[model samples]
Target: MHDTIFDQLERDGFAVVEEFLRDAECEELVAAGLELTRHLPDAPPTVFSTTEPEQQQLKDKYFMESNDKISYFYEKDALDADGKLQLDPSISLNKVGHALHLLHPIFRCYTYSERVKALCRELRLLEPAVVQSMYIYKNPGIGGEVVPHQDISYLYTEPIPPIGFWIALQDATIQNGCLWIARGSHKSAVHRRMLRSPEDRNKCIYDRPAPVYPESSFTPVPVSKGTCILIHGNVVHRSAPNRSAASRPAYTFHVVERKGNNYSEDNWLQEGENAPFLNIYTTSQMQ
Candidate 1:
């Protein structure tokens, strides 16, 4: 299993681990998420809009109005009369820095599995560390396409290298905007020019034009409920808009090496500061 996942990630810049979660665990997580949403007072504002420029601008505005921390959780609620909750979505990001310790065992098991460690070896990262995790939901006709970009571009890290595990809470099909990856893209030098905004320009490592990969060389990765797609930090990837009749839900966790080669502190978020959904935890405490 490890070899297969590793090989796929090497050749494609991403791999899918199928059935990573048991049916019981999947149902539990879904229930918990739904329950959390029930407590919200209002629905979350849509984050995606038409036009790359408009989407970029909205994202920039959200970042500025939000805390400096790039990781956090969002909850949207439908309220009843007298300010009671009707329904809601419980979403969060930055799991490692925020709530890994508090996560259900099943969720942690998927991220910390041996297969994941082996993939880290293929990436040349040692003593891997999970940086954060994000939980997101797309209600019917509510989610939009995630622009093509690299994950490392949004994070502040010296080495600018990491791995991502995107777990699907429901069936992720092409119609639901499953993830798309540029095959073998991670092997190239990091691109620095595709960014479309200037608000947090420095936060992005790439400034060059978007590199085009032939469709024949790339593939859309689809996974059933309870599966995950593992991707490299430098990998060029994106997701289509969720067009499925039902809501689409997913989670993403970022991991990196602990004391491995190419370690740098320049881009690391300052300790004790709140980032997105992540609270603060020291390196030692994380272990």
Candidate 2:
């Protein structure tokens, strides 16, 4: 079965593993998403933009600290003219990101589950480490558009780049901003990187120009609840704005092969020397 998964990934650049999570597992994650709001940390309102994340999100202190902390970001439409939240925090929240899989118990359990361990072994990742995780709330009617981009451009690794496990907590449909991935596009090299500037580590630097992809190169992948999509690091993908009344919430994390891989120092997400990325094989080494 794992061999089949690898085959599909090799052919398609992305593979959908239906029923990757049980109904109960999906419910728990969704419940945890709601529970997160209770522990809010007086976050100053900031809008999240995938296209210009460096300009919009990097400027905020909360975003810079989110690497090891579960932080909140609001949707642009969730705010009013004066930059105040016009809707409920639950309705306005764009995402709680960068470290839930490491810091939150519920998230940590799933991230280190036997099922995930099996995947690590299949990839021959002797020491698999997860550097980042996110719980994206693609809320109804005004959910934002995520511009086409590659995962390795951000959480990059040398020789063997990380892969993404994007699990859906709710049904993701075309009407609700389901992901649109370019078929077999992983064969292309990553032309740009969203890295930290040398002069200002807090700022971002794009090593090359963003490549333009034609619409015919992509396909919409609508999946039921509890499904998981395995995305290659260089796969070009994006999601349209959610125009329906329902939400398309998903939990995603990237796993880097720690055996013989070099994680770029200039990557926007950098953990201090003492606090390193969590090794999935070494549960006790949680950071």
The lDDT leader among the candidates is 2
Q: Write the per-residue lDDT of candidate 1 for residues 1-287, one digit (tens) a residue.
A: 35676677777788878887767766766665555444433433323333344333233444332323322332222233443334433432111122332243444454556555555666666566665655566555545666667777644344547678787888888887788888788888666533323455334233454555556655688789988788877788887766568666776777755563343333323223443222122222222
C-alpha lDDT of residue 49 in model 1? 34
TM-score of each: 0.67, 0.94
Runs of candidate 2 with Cα error greater than 4 angstroms are 1-3, 52-54, 273-275, 284-287
**Count of clashing residue pairs in every prediction:** 16, 0
lDDT, each prediction = 0.55, 0.84
What candidate 1 gets wrong by more than 4 Å, as runs, is 1-3, 41-51, 54-125, 156-160, 193-217, 261-287
RMSD of each: 6.4, 2.1
TM-score of model 1 (CA atoms)? 0.67
Q: Model 1 — which ten-residue stretch has the worst lDDT?
A: 92-101
Q: Using TM-score, give the best candidate's number.
A: 2
**Range of the 10 consecutive residues with the lowest summed lDDT in candidate 2:** 52-61
